[model samples]
Target: MRSVIDIVDLSTEELDDLIKVARDIIANPDKYAHVCDRKKLATLFFEPSTRTRLSFEAAMYELGGHVISVPDAGSSSASKGESVSDTARVVSCYADIIAMRHPKEGAAFVAASKATVPVINAGDGGHCHPTQTLADLLTIELEKNRLGNLTVGFCGDLKFGRTVHSLINALSRYEGNKFVLISPEELKLPSYVKKDAIKSKGIPYEQTTNLEEAMPKLDILYMTRVQRERFFNEEDYLRLKDSYILTPEKLRKAKPDLAILHPLPRVNEISVAVDDDPRACYFKQVENGKYMRMALILKLLKEAGTL
Candidate 1:
């Protein structure tokens, strides 16, 4: 079986296939329902989450499968100092597949190395969130009708936005796509990500501090909260917390068809007023997340001979 530990682990063709499956499911839900009948999905979340965790659980339910969850590390064997690998090995005995979220970087990778069944990385610290990228791709495809030849702007906490990192890696493989990285200097996209996902790919990209300047040219405007959880210094987080807020007045300069996305739990970075705007696709992004996850679970289980 295969494990989805990073976006880079999936090729563009594979992503396209998943998106196609998600689209088909969206089009005819009844036909696709019960594809994973009688299967069990184990959600091993070592950290607290809402959207990602719930989306995975909802996806399994829609497929007529059962969910077995370790909602938090405090309630799991990990509280007794059980290792991730051991937990993965043990859980594989009870479930057909595993979707995991952890606060430590590479924790999913460690689990995937030991798990007998497919291990899907729900999220892993500031490192990566591959499944979120799947949702993002499906959203973009549904909205824009294509993945390539668009300018996308990423604003706010690029330094530790694992969703931003994963999405950029996935999109860079497509043709004619450019990136505008917008954030305060302290929260700029990490240098390693720039080197590996952007520069090494020879994809054109610009770095800027002005969100307004970038908005007018973007087909997609991706906003992220300056994650307080990733910062060691509370003072630093407070200082940069409100660097970029998307107000309606600010969005007036944006393209009428701009797709606004946020991997959310927005803490004042995006005004609630912006939700009424047709351009706001974050909520739509949430629904797409469930369908994409359903697509992933179906693929993994079928490959594992469990479906």
Candidate 2:
């Protein structure tokens, strides 16, 4: 069974195929509605996330499947200290596929390695969030017309943003793709992401602390929340927090077609004033996530021969 642990798990052709499916789902939803009829999707979320959990549940339901949710760890076997592997094996017996979210790094990997059915990593700590990357990719294609040959700026919290790292991994293979990482020194994109994903692939990228300077040059400015908890010192958080906020004044300096996106439940990183702007694509990105995931459910079930 195919399991999504990381973005690198998908080959170039497969990525193209998945994107095509996602686009097709957006174009013709009614045609694919019955594809997952009567199938089961088991969600094992140790850490509660209302958006991701609800998106998965909605995707399955819209595709005519049933859902089984483990919303909290305390109410499940995990509270008594049952291993994740044991839970995976047991859940695999009942569901055709699984999607998991956990607080610990590599928790989804541990479960996927043990499960009989295909397992999708929803989010595992700050390690990786592949599905969000899928949604971002779909958003990129829709907003910018093409994924390749575009300058995409990932602004704010690059170091801890799993969405950033996963997107870089997936996009590195596309021809002429460029990345502009806009973050403070403290939240720079991690070295493994730089060396392993960007530099190794020979994709051009530049890093800077200035978001406004990078604005007009970008086709996609992907915003992420800069959390106070990421800073060890309160003073450091207070200083850098204001640097990343997307004000209307900043948007005025951007390109006319620039797509400002966020994987949101956004904090103060993005100003409320910018929401009225036509270029704010985060909410559209959320709705698109549901359709992308709807596409995903169909693809997974087809591969499993259950569709």
User: In lDDT terms, which candidate is top?
Assistant: 1
In model 1, which range of ten residues has the least summed lDDT? 69-78
* RMSD of candidate 2 to true structure, Å: 1.3
Q: Which stretches of candidate 1 lie above 4 Å from their native place?
A: 227-243
Candidate number with greatest TM-score: 2
Candidate 1: pairs in clash: none
Instruction: Return the clash pairs for model 2, or none.
Output: none
- Give candidate 2 regions above 4 Å deviation: none
Instruction: Score candidate 1 by TM-score against the native.
Output: 0.95
lDDT of 1: 0.90
Residue 95's C-alpha lDDT in candidate 1? 95
User: Model 2 Cα displacement at 224 (Å)?
Assistant: 1.2
lDDT of each: 0.90, 0.87
Looking at candidate 2, the ten consecutive residues that score lowest on lDDT are: 67-76
